[model samples]
Target: MKKILLSFFLLTFFQNVVAQTNLYENPNFDELAKTHKIIAIVPFKTQVQLRPKQMKDMSAEQLNRVEKSEGESIQTAMYSWFLKRKKRGDLQNLEIQDPRTTTAMLKKQTIDYNNIMDFTPQELAKILEVDAVISGEFETNKPMSEGASVALGVLFGFFGSTNSATINMSVHNATDGILLWNYNKKVSGSIGSNTEDLINVLMRKSSRRLAYTKNSKDKD
Candidate 1:
């Protein structure tokens, strides 16, 4: 009985550690976030690392298209997550800029996925007319939105074990481009196989630490 109890405790501890996010919050995040009424979520910079056989079958253009699509899909999923939270009154007094408007403004500034990294967060905030911006990068071994493979993984609970993804997200204050918060996480298995599921998992863990959420300022 003692051995079984010890084993269960260890399993619970391991799960807690694996589920936690690597989060960084600026010392002045509360002060900075107080002025942040509106924010924009941008397309994540995405890189898809293909196996040799897959690489050989795809052209350079096709690879770029896949990366771009994945980036936009993540951005959209993030927006949906925030929208749902806002509707639930968890994100009080905060407004998220529509992604369509954000994209149009970026295009008006001649910024595309390839060149967006050239601009600083403050520059993007000015262009988008938001108080802050949410941006990130995603690296993955496979296309996350591949419905068939992901669905199969959901059903069988093993196919996603072969896939891996790393996400690093940050919030920057528009005034000075100082990073207010950052979250870095690595995800695998069935939960990381699709954009919606991935963002849902990530944001659920991150929302407690996010500056804009209700009562979040008091959390570590």
Candidate 2:
């Protein structure tokens, strides 16, 4: 009996490991990241408003209240993941916040975001003093169905959009904002019927496609 139980446990554990695999929509980061050094990941932010749609069963005021919480919740999760990844420190000289936050400084120097494009990556590399920079974006159905109040996103659709998320990401050289590489993925439809499940799928797929390795994926 002991031997049989042990075998079952081992089989279950191995099956669990194999079940955890990434389903990346685009899987080419290995080639691009090989050349670059420092990478920064911006937490996902989107312009999509979860208002007007979720108003089907609630007053405008009610929907607004729900959406306010939704954006903050998703962003918080993204930032937490970013910090955790940073701690792992796989890449070199990574910086999360942009040195240049405000456009006012550029105006003071009479520099245009457009005009700056001509500068080469080597030059920008010299200016920012970093090997490379990463840019990322996210859009999600937002949280809802917390046992009581639905997350912010569902309230956006007429009766709550099947709670989904879409993510688009790219890596660039700080030097002149060159698009060294990019990746995009969307998790919605019947495959993931709601927000919570959508989050699970995105993380799983990204981990695999991001390829910290073939089987294991680093948060960073």
Task: Name the candidate that leads on lDDT.
Answer: 1
Error of 1 at 45 (Å): 0.4
Clash pairs, candidate 2, are 53-157, 54-155, 54-156, 141-164, 143-151, 144-150, 144-151, 145-150
Please, what are the lDDT tens digits per residue for candidate 1 over residues 1-220?
A: 9999989865754354344358899989977777779999999999888777666876787777778888988889899888877887767888999999999999999998888999999999999999999999998786776642443234334533445678899999998999999999976654544688678767765777787873643211
Q: Give the clash count for model 1.
A: 0
lDDT against true structure, model 2: 0.44
Q: Candidates' TM-scores?
A: 0.81, 0.44
C-alpha positional error of residue 34 in candidate 2 after TM-score superposition, expressed in Å: 5.2
Candidate with best TM-score? 1
Model 1 residue 170 lDDT score = 96
Stretches of model 2 off by over 4 angstroms after superposition: 1-37, 43-45, 49-76, 86-131, 143-162, 189-201, 209-220
Evaluate residue 141 in candidate 2 and report its C-alpha lDDT on the 0 to 100 scale.
43
Q: How high is the lDDT of residue 212 in model 1?
A: 81
Lowest lDDT sum, 10 consecutive residues, model 2, at 17-26
Error of 1 at 152 (Å): 15
